[model samples]
Target: MIKKALAWLECGEIKRLDWYGHEGNPSQLLGDKQWPQRLLPLLITGKLQMRVPSIHTLGSYQNWLGYSGSNLAVQNPKLNISSIIKTKEPDFNELKFHLTGMAGDGNKGHIWLLRLMQELLNRENQTNKEITSNLRKVKLHFIGLEIDKSASLARELRYWGRAIMGENFDWTAHGNHQDTIRSMAKANIAVSCSKAETFSMASLEAMHLGNLLLRNRTGGWEEQLLDGINGFDLGETEQKPGKKEIELVHRLRNTLITPSKKLTAMSIAANKHSQIFQNIKYANWLLN
Candidate 1:
């Protein structure tokens, strides 16, 4: 099927091929073969145009072609931030944390989440006597909705999460985009644990909805997040427990200790920063 499609693409009078690489993509498959030799000529001669979502993707193509083309760069449609409204400030008693994506083994970082939740639970138990009443009762509720057909993985992860987090974790394997957005509005924090991404619309939507974002400092997120300001830079801590993971857990714990006013202010700042990716600005960029 991929060979036939590639043959057609090579022979067809197609002017442009806007490629978005994903798992099981034909371009990736063909690129591993000899598609670059066939496509590079067309690309260099301005007969074909290629656009990807991020510099990381562009770099991949450049490496495949053994040269960079003028047409290849990071470009993606702007997010519709119009539907996103500022959520009400969360109280200290219960704080909702959200993660939305495929529950696949490679995509979502479920293990990291389980570890973080365990750390939070341990912190609460250890500091129960020393903390204030509000802090003592504070609970971090994790709401995860799998957007792909990874039901079994989601179920398995949920079992582990429950073991680690007790009553604080919830997982849904079948969820639509609307359901995810609705849940995001109620969340105090939105986490993105993907090892790599082109452009994370979920993280952007979370920011637009005034949810504090904690995302890995890689891919398009590097362009979007302002470390320690709009969001925290989550480094590689998923494989093994490290300082970054500990710092993230500490920051979440500090949220319970911080005043509501300060947290609200931070949320507002995050929302404002996210406006750069709104539809209006995106449309203008397209026109220009």
Candidate 2:
């Protein structure tokens, strides 16, 4: 818009306006060092009205408000843009887990998952007075591979899975990637134990497959997840939901114990509610 306007209007004219872009600043086209310093200054000074999607260039793009900000509505009032939109998870109904190997490794939330599992198991055991009630209810399947593909992280994840499962837990560990995907397909719910995420593909994929998502609160997860509606959002300390992590664990246990059929109903609601946002709509808005 700015370019055509500039060409049509008189040369050497400048105007004060806002500019936006995705991933990186458009002024960077001038040159690496000079993009921000030289060219963007000219455009901003020259009255260019630039707008970019906040999700694509969130922290990097300047002059534009964050995508989640209210300014986008001001600029384009008619556009119905949502932050994070997902599809409903499938109705597996039977509580099964196919934790991705990639998740339980790296400097990510692997340890957090272990700790959460332990806490949940302890709580479940206390409830039934058997100490193994929770462990017995949940069956984990490790689908992604490790060492044969030359990934040390994979090997570590496999070892950790085995260690966590132990002899008493009714769990199985597999290294076949295809079998893992199949297991994920058959599972009732998907659990994402990620520490940091800009957006969650695993969580989204689980939603797409009609499996209810049980995930942590961080990054773009908040934008995508609708607590108590589509799925459960855990460990949030805010007053809106008014529950801490410990409380969230209790709620989770309560939900699980109600019967798989009830959970399946929640999963259906989750999948139905996730269709509000589409990537193409976001893309078109950006291009517009």
Candidate 3:
């Protein structure tokens, strides 16, 4: 919309522009960057509007707004929430994990899958006595476009994981959104790894499901994940597999290692916190 807003506004086709985004301002929109309509007072004045899905983005993307002329950004960014009906998780004895929104490389789907599989391999080494209640026969499911053929290391790890863990540890890859939602309904935990984001929908959905989130705190995630409250805190996103990634899995592996007072409280808090977002009426939010 940024690219075409100038032309449309100049042509008098779009008098005012309202752009909505879930992520932070694009890199191109930062620094000494120009909004195409900036120079033309008649076309630019009160014409370029950015509507971020979360108000938290206002503070998070402050730098971007600085160089990009924040005068036009007077309106508050509103939170965009979906009405996902809270469903009851199915009765199951085994551990179930839902890796949140692996929408291809941007979300680093392959990295998350590999780290989880690596942790599962670690669990395979432990005997039934060594394994905790959370480690016995685990199941993880993710749905999205598959990683490209060039992701050799990730693919190799997955191969080894399935070969060693066999049916005892099922890591299912899916493509259907409906099925993924259903799978989430059955999961007890969620691991959503993203390079960057601002109040992501996937994270919101996971919280609404009463699933304990296990993601590296990124962007506005801090506003939702209260460290060991609703989710464990990792430093940041990583391009390579590292301790943080493994620690994420390790945390999940023994989330109930000794059963702390925070377990059910975390889920309850996550569900409760997400409900604030759910209450938002998008149209009314945008207008007001």
Candidate 4:
């Protein structure tokens, strides 16, 4: 079906072909022989125009083509800041760490949350602990929205999390947009474990709702998430929890036991950071 449409467009009287490329859906011309033979000639002849969300993706395509052309770096649509209602005070009796996205095969890297949970449990079991008494009283709950229910890896991870965390973890394989927003509202921190992302709408929404973002350093997340300010990056070089992750855990533990004033202040800072992605700014960029 895609081939037929491309063929028609190639032969038709169209002025130009505008295409959107990302990690998942790259240009067919950069792929196997079948489509490239049919599509590359047209693309090279100056008939094709492309738009990508990030410089990283644009560079990949440019390197593949061996030269730059009409590829434009138009970012993905930003979150609507107005729709998110900032909470003045969020209950921290049980520190809710929420992650929403696909889960399976480590594609979305949702399994990292499970790993972090295991690490926390291990620390709690240690004989000699330096953690404060108030920090020990703060419970942690992992809430996940698994967008892809059929993903085998995600399903397996969910089962493993339940087995380990028991009642401390909850996974909703099928959830609507509203359900995700509600989860964000109640969450103390929003976590993303994806190995890569063109742009993470889930993380952005979490920030808009004034939840501290705990995201991996990848994709457009770095653009909005400032370490130690709006959120903390889970390091880019390696996967395992290192100094940054340890510090983040410590901070979360401390935040849970801190007064509401400190939590509210953090929320306000996150909300301020999220303002750059407002719909008005996105509209102006698009228009220009």
Best candidate according to TM-score: 1
Q: Report per-prediction Cα RMSD to one decimal.
A: 3.8, 8.1, 4.9, 4.1
Give the lowest summed-lDDT range of ten residues in model 4: 136-145
Clashing pairs in 3: none
Q: What TM-score would candidate 1 get against the native?
A: 0.80
Local accuracy of candidate 4 as per-residue lDDT tens digits, 1-288: 556657667888565666666663365434764554555566667566556665545666665555465534455656765556556565555567787775545766666667776776666566244555545233333345444546677667767878778877776654667766776687777877777777677777887788877877666665767876776778672566665675567566663445556665666778787777674354443343
Model 3 C-alpha lDDT per residue in residues 72-136, reported as the tens digit of each score:
33232233434344577322344566665544444545455555566656755663754554553
Misplaced by over 4 Å in model 4 are 1-12, 24-30, 33-47, 67-70, 81-88, 91-94, 127-130, 136-155, 237-239, 255-263, 280-288
Number of backbone collisions per candidate, in order?
0, 12, 0, 1
Each candidate structure's TM-score, on Cα atoms with residue i matched to residue i, is 0.80, 0.59, 0.71, 0.77
lDDT of 2 at 124: 68
Write the residue-wise lDDT of candidate 2 on 157-213 in tens digits: 556656765542222344453444455666656666554443455565556556677
Q: Of models 1 and 2, which has the larger lDDT? A: 1
Q: Any idea what lDDT model 3 has? A: 0.57
Model 1 clash pairs are none
Q: Estimate the TM-score for candidate 3.
A: 0.71
Winner by lDDT: 4
Which residue pairs clash in candidate 4?
104-154
